[model samples]
Target: MAKGYKQMLAEADALVVSVTAEEMAGKLEDDSIVLVDIRDPRELEREGMIPGARHAPRGMLEFWIDPESPYHKPWFAEDKIYVFYCASGWRSLLATRVAQEMGLDAQNLRGGFSGWKKDGHPTAVKEKRRT
Candidate 1:
């Protein structure tokens, strides 16, 4: 029997959750959340992070998010409230949805990093090396 393309695509997108950065900020301020930055190292190396956000990287998100995986400890704690983010927020949205599917209380940062920048939040610039 042949598989349906739509069914495959839908399955591909089945696990992801989403939220806005503004909503995240409010939650963070109240000490109610944990920020997970799932962007690649190159992007973060170029643009820096949102101060206290943990680096998980999209490539290994599923692995790291899994309690059975060794990479889980650094990112997960008991009852952790994770909020993943990316450059444009789409990635984070997809990620959070996946987390939700995985039975985790996760959300995505709206507008991703850009939302934070637009809100007058601080961002660190990678200093050019003068060799």
Candidate 2:
């Protein structure tokens, strides 16, 4: 039998550390932390993201994190606490686990962007990138 989404989420959850929106909000001013939003472009356009969060779409995450990959993002090489979030917490939980395995100090945003909005945290509209 193949592992289902639930099994994957459970495995990821057990391995990754998750921080609540309130806790994350307190770290907004912390320079040592890096907020990473791992959602689709459409989702970001429809719903704004956390202020100061860097957009790293989920599909390209592995490539972006791998230093040897041509798609590697230099920021991912920085020595900072990376907090990954999606619209909901599920995607981020899995992403966090992969990041952690890749040797980054990564954590998941509990309840994700929805939770952050519900908690009244500040958000900023993402301008469409010119490719």
Candidate 3:
């Protein structure tokens, strides 16, 4: 039987660092941290993202993270703490686990963008993606 979403989230949460919005806010001041937004384009358009976060759609995460892949983004090669977030924490937890497995230093923002907003962190409007 396939594992349920909650089980997967629990497993991922255990393996990946889950930081609170306040913690993430402090980390933003560090030059060695990269904030990655993994939410869909539509979601971003509807709700914005953490200021200065890189937009890496969830579907392309693996390709973008692999150095050997043609789709790899140069930013990923930099030695920085990758901090991923989505509309909520669920997607980020899983993504962080996957990135960790790929040998990347990664962590997820606890409660994701929603938590950020709830915690009163500033958000920036997302730029429209090129088609």
Tell me, by TM-score, which candidate is best: 2
> On residues 1-131, what C-alpha lDDT tens digit does candidate 3 reach at each position?
99999999998988888889998888777889999999999999989988888999999999999999999999998999999999888998999999999988998999999999999999999767788
Write out the backbone clash pairs for model 1: 15-97, 15-98, 16-96, 16-97, 16-98, 17-96, 17-97, 20-110, 21-110
Ten-residue region with minimum lDDT total, candidate 2: 122-131
Evaluate all candidate structures by whole-model CA lDDT and list the values in order: 0.73, 0.96, 0.92
lDDT (0-100) at residue 74 of candidate 2?
100
Runs in model 1 with CA error above 4 Å? 1-18, 124-131
* Model 1, span 43-125: residue lDDT tens: 88788778778778788888877888877755465477788888977777777877776777886677889888788776765
Q: Rank order by TM-score, top first?
A: 2, 3, 1
For 1-131, candidate 2 gives per-residue lDDT tens digits of: 99999999999999989999999999998999999999999899889999999999999999999999999999999999999999989999999999999999999999999999998999999887677
In model 1, the worst 10-residue window by lDDT is 8-17
Better of 2 and 3 by lDDT: 2
**For every model shown, what is its TM-score relative to the native structure?**
0.74, 0.96, 0.95
